[model samples]
Target: MNFTGQWVAFKTIVYREIHRFMRIWVQTLVPPAITIALYFLIFGQLIGSRIGQMGGFDYMQFVVPGLIMMAVIQNSYANVVSSFFGTKFQRNIEELLVAPVLEITILLGYIVGGMARGIAVGSIVTLLALFFTDLTVNNWWITISMVLLTAIVFSLTGFINAIFAESFDDISIIPTFVLTPMIYLGGVFYSIDLLPSFWAKISLANPILYMVNGFRYGILGVSDINIWQAYGMLVVFVIIGFSVSLYLLAKAEKLRT
Candidate 1:
């Protein structure tokens, strides 16, 4: 349709998404804040006390970036997957597909929604973290850029998962079995450098590692991997996720059936 039409459609989708999550702030927003606070209390305060320093920062400080990134990744992914799948389950996605809106527009509308939730939740978690440690931004650009890119990548990922999901259980599987492990092993609580040589090399395979390290570098000015490499990978994943999501959306028959 025309530019104005597309803009209206986009705004409607984003507004709906924002409103849905905000309407249930207790579920979407409060849970992450409480969970992160518990992590700070248990991992940062209790265990971190005995662990002392990691990568030249206090254990609590070192984990702040990772925890925030984790919040962004999880919420961004969950928001889109659940929202898109809900549309599918209700069989309302066919309406959007038959409408004049472009496939990319639909993809982006959902993505923007996911990114909004992810960034919002991440910001809240970051604020909560301040109570436990003196967090500083070593590189504002890198920090913000990495977080934004990571959110987009995962938002796209959630869209892909939603397309392939046949049931509600399918949506939970990847996050439980796949995403959780990746995040934990992604260097959220510890650095890969602390791993033995062979295992450290293996950690490189986890995409979350680059994201966590890039974010940590932004916050702490240190990283086990080159920052540029992390930036490149994040961009590449965004492209791949976007392409896959578009392809799935194009298969309207398969999706609607």
Candidate 2:
């Protein structure tokens, strides 16, 4: 396809994706906000009070960044995996495969769409966070960059999951078995310093820990992990994920069954 044609195709795919989640605002949006808010109440307020300060800041303040990041990661991944898999389930993806659109355009379109929902839901969670804690951002650029990069990484992962997923159940497996554990253990509620020396070293292996801590550094000016490492991990993931998703997308047999 020509540049103009590719641009139009990209916009159409992105628009459909944004519209799909927005159309079901109650399901796609509200639930995460409510869930995160409850975390702020129960964990940040009730339990946090007893736990005292974490990383030299109020526990609520400390957990807010991680919670927001969690919201972004989940929604971004869910949007693409569910949407693309739904298209496959409906057999509509075959049309795109035979069309003149560039594969990169399709991938970019879905990536942007997932980023939209992820960022949107993250914003909502952030707003709700204000009700519980006072967040003074330490670095606006680091904060913004982390959120965007984290969203892109997970959005790409979701696209990848959708590519290999054969059924709706297949989509849920990763989020349940893999993503959930990573987020909780990724220093959402506690710092790695509290971990035993061996486990703390092991925590270093989890990519989500870098992201959560990077975001926490942006907001609270404190991090257990090096901020530069988080940036490196996110950049590397985006490059690798795009390459993998593109290669998988190019394999027509996967989408066609």
Candidate 3:
């Protein structure tokens, strides 16, 4: 396809994706805000009161970055998985596959959609967090980079999940069984430093730990892991996830049929 043709196709896909979630703002947008608010009330206000400080910062302050990152990660992954799987279930993905649009264009269109939802939801969570604590950005560059990279990584992951999912239940299974557990143990509410040495080392294996700590470092100027290491991990994951997603997209017959 010519450049103009590709651009048009990309724009159409992205627009459709944005419109899909916006059409149901209540479901896509409102729920995360409410859930995160509850976390602030229960975990931040109630439990955090007794806990006092973590990592030399107010408990509420410390948890804010993690919670925001959590929102971003989950929503980004969910948006793409659900959106792509919906196309497959409806048997319309075949149209895109057979079209002149490049496979990479399709992948990017869906990714951009996921990133949009993730960043939008994360921003809302950040605004809500302000009510619970006076948050500050310690490093704007690191802060923005981590959040964007994390969103891209998870968005690509969601694309992979969608390709492999055969049913609606399959989509929810990973988020429930795998994603949720990792996020909770990813230092959302607490630091790994608080854990025993063995468990702390084990926690290092959870990819979400790097994301959370990297984002926390951006906000609070402190992290359980080196910020550069976290950035490298995120980049690596993005590359792997994107490559996997493209490979799956190339297998259009298997995915669509």
Residue 144 lDDT in model 3?
96
Residue range 97-155, candidate 3, lDDT tens digits: 78999999999999999999999999999999998899889999999999999999999
**Per-model C-alpha lDDT, please?**
0.94, 0.94, 0.94
Q: The CA-based lDDT of model 2 is what?
A: 0.94
TM-score of each: 0.98, 0.98, 0.98
**Range of the 10 consecutive residues with the lowest summed lDDT in candidate 1:** 248-257
Q: What range of 10 consecutive residues in model 3 has the weakest lDDT sum?
A: 248-257
Off by over 4 Å in 1: none
Task: Write one digit per residue (lDDT tens) for candidate 1, span 1-257.
Answer: 89999999999899999998899899999999999999999999999999999999999999999999999999999999999999999988878978899888899999999999999999999999999999889999999999999999999999999998989999999999999999999999999989999999999999999999999999999898999999999999999999988988887655765
> Over the stretch 1-257, how does candidate 2's per-residue lDDT look in tens digits?
79999999999999999999999999999999999999999999999988888899988888999999999999999999999999999989987888999889999999999999999999999989988988799999999999999999999999999998998889999999999999999999899999999999999999999999999999889999999999999999999999999998887568755
Residue pairs whose backbone atoms clash in candidate 2: none
